[model samples]
Target: MPAGSPKVPVKFDKVQKYFGPVKVLEQFDLDVAPGEFLVLLGASGSGKTTALRILSGLETATAGRVVIGERDVTNILPKYRDVSMVFQSYALYPHKTVAENIGFPLKVRRVAKAEMDSAIRDAASQVQLGDLLDRYPRELSGGQRQRVALARAIIRRPSVFLMDEPLSNLDAKLRGYMRAELKHMQQALGITTIYVTHDQIEAMTLAHRVAILDRGVLQQLATPAEIYNDPANLFVAQFIGSPPMNIVRGGLEGRYFLTNGARIDSPVGGHVDKAILGVRPEDCAVVAPENVALKGVIYTTELIGDHTLVTVEIGHDKLTVKASKDIHGNQGDTVGVALRREHLYVFDAASGQRIR
Candidate 1:
């Protein structure tokens, strides 16, 4: 967002969608703050794309309202809605040079020739594509093509920017580089952007707030930090983290929760009978045998470059712990693990909701 630019609010009120008899979205409600980067995250068939398509005017909702700055855009045409979209495929014209591709939108809007040239040059520079302006899409690298796509989107200077997995095709190294670049570009442009992705890391890294959906229902809408540190329910706790959280089944025993045969003080909420316990890999620590919170035998130690991922067996279940670079633990070793009590997550076994 620019220093003095006004904010644009986007809202989805009671949105619903169905494919024949199958419902893809149900009573979906979301409010995106002005200049906020909101990511819609979910697995395939989770309706994330459908939501984006609805906003893009490519798909119509069966019920509900899509609003941009208080205007009901549910029935508005994509071109008239002041929105620009960048797709995963780049979707660049094969024979058109980068400059022509970017200037197409401006030309469509009848922007004056001189103004279009200026806008195209500025957008090309903004995306570091100035040097490649004469190159056709077929002559560019994957990253270069993506930049051209981004440049085209920026040249429109629309109020809202919609991106659907714009970096899914890049290689690992390029994906990482572009992730940071995309974040920086979005911040610089200050557009009200809505990004849709199935990658949890992308959602966490790029979003001001994430809106997670599953089975057509919204599970959570919150800041990335809040969603990660304080999950609203079991699905959120399980979905937000890399390697996911360690969810162990336990029974309440004598004011403490017992996993396998090891005893640890119960988290704040428990029924003294049964509950689901969750601990992040980072929160699980290796401790002296006598001070161990749980006794488990190391089943495997996976070296993931910078850190070792140790999976320990407690009873019949396996719990993964992220070991620091300097911490050494071998496979099949009897390890004493201590789980941080304050960071423990407790959820209802039946409802899957947080108990405390």
Candidate 2:
């Protein structure tokens, strides 16, 4: 989206989809503001990709409407929807040069040769592919191929950008590089973007807001920080973090979480026969095993550069503790885990719902 490129909102209103006997999206509702970067995040079979496809007119919704800006585009053909999509596959033309590939969108609409060439160069330059415009897809690296796809999408100047795991093909390092380029490019262009990915890193690093879905249902939608810090349910709490938020099966006794004969105080108060106490690895401290509520033998230790992740076996469950990088511990060493009450989360065991 260049300086005056159209910026529009997107919405999915009470959307539902089913594949014969199996339901996909159930009452899915989401609203994306104008020029906002929204990421649809979920694992495979979560229906995230299906929702995106419906919006792009590639897959028709079983029920409900898809709105782009002020128009109800549920029945519109893709080309007439005024939206651009970049798929997991780069989808570049093998026989076409980068310039020709990028300018293809305009060429279809019969833009003048001079204008098409200018637009192609502008789009290529935006993705830092200017110097390689004459190269064919075969000559470009994975990242370059991705950029060509991006440039192709850009030349359309569509009202919305739809990307489906666009960088999944690249190597890890290249993926990271492209993620940065994508964030920068999106910010520069200010296009209303709807990106779909299973990678939480991409969802966290690139989105203005994230819509987390599970089993075709939108689990939670919020800013990445909010979703990370205050997950809506047990599923979200466990799904978000790397190494993940630790779940200790327990019962609630007053303000304490009772687990394996250990009574730990928590910030939230509730009582349930079957409950779970959730805490992030970083929230627990490793200390000397002396009259502590949690004393465990070290199961394993991993030095993850910035921190040493200590896995402590407390009874039947294990808790991961983020300790100092230089911390020393061997297998079966007894240690104490000190948990701060403020960081603990309580959830219902039966429903997997967060207990306020």
Candidate 3:
């Protein structure tokens, strides 16, 4: 760990939030290890931002407790909690120079000028903004402005770092670069960080562990590989993948899945009137139409650099098969989809739970 202040664990016990009659978070429970990067991931209105606000003391939880390093901070003032937040909007003074913006935190605390200047230089160096200190916010680029905001946040090195989609405003290429910068800074600072983002790529690449939420409820919390390979339910299965996992409605018969007029073998055995079969694009292949259990007309073929995604229309559903880069196919070509049984995921249609 990088040399810094002592790191402390954070906990949420039965946290609940409500705006009038609308429930945003219901008995939210999570534990973030000391000096760990945890990402809260979900779609819009999924209660991710609500939870972060609650932790930051900006929005109080309707019930439960928020603990930081064994201190009950649920009712503490936001400033008193010793946490710094980085907002999606670059919250910087337009007239303030980079050094002034970074040193503003210390200025508020009335630190000595010499100590404050030293801290500002240290923080700016961490974010690679040492050369831009004399420039005003308007003189900097989007990424530079973001780095200034980050420097302001880390200038204090509080117990925990709260970042709410800090990179969302940047373009794709810049976002990628900033993600690397954020990860490196966090590791070097050894600060406990809670980052919130709806972008799966960000969560997957940056978080030590991702906590996926939906409608104020945490669906699953696990490493990226575990969450991808063994999703807790249908929501996570569909949400995490880039192109999303393909779902086929079918009936389960013993160890087989029956869709349309075809019967396909599954790894898990179960009998149900309704079932959903999920297979990722990378786990499926396009084959000759006559020999497979599922055959359909190719709806479209998308060449995505490294591979070709062939979407086959099987009755009412379409399955995207990840084929080689050189694979050739037309829009209306007849093709068969071969799903690897070991990689298939079966979900109970009524409950949305995975069938192990």
lDDT per model vs. reference? 0.88, 0.92, 0.93
What's the distance in Å from true for residue 87, model 1?
0.7
lDDT of 2: 0.92
Give me the runs in candidate 2 sitting further than 4 Å from their true place. 1-4
Whole-structure CA lDDT of model 3: 0.93
lDDT, candidate 2, 44-153, per-residue tens: 99999999999999999999999999999999998889899999998888999999999988888999898888888899998999999889999999899999999999
Q: Provide TM-scores for the models.
A: 0.95, 0.98, 0.98
Model 1, position 155, has a per-residue lDDT of 81
For TM-score, candidate 1 versus 2, the one ahead is 2
lDDT for residue 71 in candidate 1, whole number 0-100: 87
Task: Output the better candidate (2/3) by lDDT.
Answer: 3
> Least accurate stretch of 10 residues (summed lDDT) in model 1?
1-10
Q: Regarding lDDT, does 1 or 2 come out ahead?
A: 2
Q: lDDT (0-100) at residue 164 of candidate 1?
A: 96
For 1-356, candidate 3 gives per-residue lDDT tens digits of: 11355898999999999999999999999999999999999999999999999999999999999999989999999999989999999899998999999999889899889888889999999899999999999999999999999999998879999999999999999999999999998998889999999999999999999999999999999999999999999999999998899999998999899997999998889798899999999999998988797999999988889988889999999998889999988989988899999999999999999999
Candidate 1 local lDDT, 146-197, one digit each (tens): 9899989888778889999999999989889898988998899788999999
